[model samples]
Target: MDPIQRITTPTLDVLDALLTVDGPAWGLLVIKATGRQAGTVYPILERLERQGWITSSWDDETDRPGPRRRLYEFTPDGVDAARDLVAARPSAATPAPSAATPARPARSARPVTS
Candidate 1:
């Protein structure tokens, strides 16, 4: 397994989302993308930053109050990492065919003794 490909579950999801978009995404966008709350999304984004898979900066243009919204973007490795993760997503489970459909082989008849 590639070392970077082993990124934690939440981090992988965040990176994949960032990779899909044309530019960086703010926290709310990430939240919407992953259906994850800020509590979960922020921590994962921090981890991705630490891993060097993604980078973030404050968005001064956003109208949000308090601090500028932190926007995230994927590094080259982040894109590669996302690709690996996507390739690794477990295939959807498929039900096995019914056993009843297979026919049993017929037994050969034995010759009768004289």
Candidate 2:
């Protein structure tokens, strides 16, 4: 697989989401896991597939009563690459700030008239 040219945060998030799953992940699952919209997730998936980082196939289960979902999983080499990439980003491992942690107040745009 060619090296990913630009590893954006959304891409990292998608990779991280994929890592958490045991088997091939569908697009919506990745979307929900990353809390990213379809617009952002689908393109990343397509790019990853094009770069050979991942492979996709249409779900063939006949019993399922819905549209065939495209399943995506990393190639043997892709998994290692993805893990290394995700691990290198410190922010990826950082947990979301909890409610107990006070949020920083947003600065007002208007200048103070004092």
Candidate 3:
């Protein structure tokens, strides 16, 4: 399946949140940003990691499986991709349709002539 097609709005939201956060975040923050369940968010995170879009490592300083966190952060490619995503964001601030680029005249709308 197409990767973009598989990416839901939540997936994009989660990705954006990760980029926004300077440090690694726990699963909870991801769930909050995407408004998705832990189950759903984790899988997407794993997929992104496996795809080399992001990387994750357990905090050495944190107590593993205790209060420790499994933090994640974007790779260089991920940053580039995020920038691309941001640029692609549609903005309402954009001016209305310009008359310069008029809609194409429909073939069916051609006038009947003798």
Candidate 4:
């Protein structure tokens, strides 16, 4: 499987969600797990498929009430690459405000100009 070419927050989020599951996942499940909109999630899935990092297949359960879901799973090699990429990414759990990009000052900090 080919490694993902361009990595972004959305892409990484999708990958992270996939890694948590034990098997293939569907688009809606991924959207929920990543907290990404459908617009962002589908394109990311397509690109990852094109890059050969993942594969998709339609679920074949005939007993289901609605249409079959398209499930996505990382290719064997993709699992390893995804782990490495995530490990290298900066942690987003709780970003500290750096001096270069300071957080907004409190309302009381503003000068009491006439």
Candidate 5:
């Protein structure tokens, strides 16, 4: 992610969760940790992926119970950058979005045309 990008509260919570963990994190885990809905958590995850800050893969361990999970973790450079961003603004890390905050519009599968 660009250093100058505006880090939203949800994004900061996600980063904090990832940083505190020992290994790669999954979507549900992050969602619980941040106390944010899937809508808020997922878009931030996608944006982070597009910015090359994080990587994800399917958990293929057969020994594990339950369905496969998509796991995520920061890239080598992203580790430092994430820490810097969090440390730079500790007060910005709010875990929940207020009820007054407007929800983002859902994206449609079809492409828009003029």
Candidate 6:
């Protein structure tokens, strides 16, 4: 895909989520991975497809009972581009600490009064 003009945090999140998967990923899987809403994830996926960064196809399996899911995967060039882009952004590589992780206390510049 031509270099993404608007690379927002949400877009990075989606790319990161896709990269984590070994194979093609579905819309709901992306949403859950990125913790983003359908409104956010679907548009990004569409944009990526339009840009030629990714391609999508409907799941062909008929044995399962649910609706056919659309699976998305990066094109060969897209994977290279995405990895370079994501690596350049250090913030995206480092995940935010969760509630279970202890927060570091801020060090005071001035001494505390007894």
TM-score per model over all chains: 0.65, 0.79, 0.65, 0.78, 0.73, 0.78
Write out the backbone clash pairs for model 3: none
Lowest-scoring 10 consecutive residues by lDDT in candidate 5?
A: 88-97
Best by lDDT: 2
lDDT of 3 at 23: 77
- Candidate 2 or 3, higher lDDT? 2
Global lDDT scores for all candidate models: 0.74, 0.95, 0.73, 0.88, 0.85, 0.93
lDDT of 6 by residue, 58-101 (tens): 99999988999999999999998888888877876578889998
**C-alpha displacement of 29 in model 6, angstroms?**
0.1
| TM accuracy, model 5 | 0.73
For candidate 2, give the lDDT of residue 13: 97
List pairs with backbone clashes in candidate 1.
none
Mind giving the per-residue lDDT tens digits that candidate 1 earns over 3-43?
45445567656766787788889888888988877898898
Write the candidate numbers in order of decreasing lDDT: 2, 6, 4, 5, 1, 3
Best by TM-score: 2
TM-score of 6: 0.78
Native-to-model Cα distance after best TM-score fit, residue 111 in candidate 1, in Å = 57
Candidate 1: global Cα-lDDT? 0.74
Off by over 4 Å in 3: 1-5, 63-65, 91-114
Clashes of each: 0, 0, 0, 0, 0, 0
